[model samples]
Target: MTKGLPMRRNTILLAIGVCAVFGAIGLFALHMSSTSVRASGLMPYQDARAIELGKTLYEEYCASCHSTNLEGEPNWRDRDDDGYLPAPPHDPSGHTWHHPDQQLFMITKYGTEKMVGDGYKSRMIGFKDSLSDTEILSALAYIKSTWPPGIIARHNKINGN
Candidate 1:
C-alpha cells in the first residue's frame, strides 16, 4: 500500500493537469467564437467581395455627407443653422458603434426621422428606395470591418453575440 501511494498521487495530479489544459482550451474557443464577426450579427463583414462592393456603394451614396474617409462634417454633433445635425462619423470616434446591428439596419433603411418620430428633425434620408437590403447590409459591413478588433469585440457584445 505504501509503495502505491506515490503512484496514486502522480496519477491524480496528471488528471488534474489534463483537465485544466482542456478547460483553458475550451474557454479560448468559446471566446473566439463569441467575438467572431459572423456571430456579431448582421451581414458578413469578413467577406472581401461584400466589403469591396460596400466601399463602392459608400463612395457613391455616403461620401458626400459622411466623407470618403468616414469622417463626418465638422462639428458633427452640433446642429446646422437649419437646426439639422450634420452626418455623423462611421469611425470609432463616433457613436455609430454604440448601436446594435438591427438598429443600424433599421436606421439605414428607414432614416432617422422615421425611427425617432415625434417631430424629430434629421437630414438623413432613407435608402430603401435606392439601395437593396443586401446593399445596405454590405455597406454597413464595410463600415464595421473598418473598426479595430477591440471595437469589433465590444460591438459583438452589444449585439449579444
Candidate 2:
C-alpha cells in the first residue's frame, strides 16, 4: 500500500509539472499575441529607435535576399528552379506596399508558407521564433518608412486609415 501511495504521489507531481509547463506556454503565447498586431496597426515607422532597430535587423536578416537597398532579387517576379519566388523589394516600386499593415505583420511573423496555406512552399521562414514581436513590427515600419509620401498615402488607405 505504501508503494502504491508513492507511485500515486509521483504521478500527481508529474501531472502538476506538465500543467505548469502548459500554463507557462499559454501565458507566453498570450503575451506574444497581445504585443503583435494592434488594432490601430503599424506603430513603429516614424519612431526613431524603431526605425534604427529595423534598419539593423533588415541589414542582418533581410539584406542577403532582399538586397541592401531593398531592391530585392533580379527578376524578383520569377520563380527559381526550386519553385520559390525570389524575395521582393520593400521599397515604393515593389508590391510590398500593396498589402495592408496587418497582412505584412502576419507574413513576416508566420512566413509565406503558413500565410498562404496548404500546398505552398516558401523560402521565407517565419521570424516568430527568431525575432521578437517588437522587432517584427519595427522591421515592417522601416520598410514602410522608405516609401514615398503618395505611396504611403495609398497604403494608409488600404489599411483603412
Candidate 3:
C-alpha cells in the first residue's frame, strides 16, 4: 500500500460526489422550467403581448381566407367550385371555438390536409415553415381572445380548465 493510495481514493470519491450533485441539479432545473405553454406542450393564450402579435399574424396570413373581421367567407358552409370547404370564422359563432386548444394548434401548425386526411383539400396551408410554433400559438391566442366570455369559458372547459 502506497502512502498516497488513501488520498487517491478520497479524491475519486469527491469527484463522483460532485458529478452526482450536478446531475441532480440539472434534473431540478428541467423540472423547474416554466416556459412550457401548457402541461401538454401547447400554447398559453392569455398573455396580452402574445395576443397582439397573433393579431398581426392573423391579418397577414389568415385574413385573406378567414376574413379580416374573423367572419370567414360568405358561403363558408358551402363547398366551392372545387368542392373544398371555405375557411370558417374564428369567432364564437364559428366551429373554431368548438375544438380544444391543442386540436386548434395542430390544425394551424399542420394544415387541413395533414390534420384531416389525404382526401381533404383546402387553401389554408400549414404555417410550419413561415411561422414558428410560438407564432402559431400567438395567432390562435388572438382568435380565442376575441370570443365572448361564455365561449371563452366553454373553451377553457374544453381545454380541461
Best by TM-score: 2
- The segments of candidate 1 whose C-alpha lies over 4 angstroms from its true place after superposition are 1-40
Ranking by TM-score: 2, 1, 3
lDDT tens readout by residue for model 2, 30-100: 44556536635674678889989999999888899899899998877655899776888888877788776
Off by over 4 Å in 3: 1-43
* Clashes per candidate (backbone, < 3 Å): 0, 0, 0
Q: For candidate 1, lDDT tens digit of each residue in 38-98?
A: 3346856889999999999999988899999998889786567997878989999987887
What does candidate 3's lDDT look like per residue over 1-161, in tens digits?
99999878867875674355334433433443453444242445679999999999999999999999999988676568996767888887687876666666666766766655535566778888898878999999899889888998887876677
Best by lDDT: 1
| Model 2 Cα shift for residue 10 (angstroms) | 64
- What are the runs in model 2 whose C-alpha is more than 4 Å off? 1-36
Clash list (residue pairs), candidate 1: none
How far off is model 2, as Cα RMSD? 16.9
Winner by TM-score between candidate 3 and candidate 2: 2
lDDT of each: 0.76, 0.75, 0.73
Worst 10 residues of 1 by lDDT: 31-40
Clashing pairs in 3: none
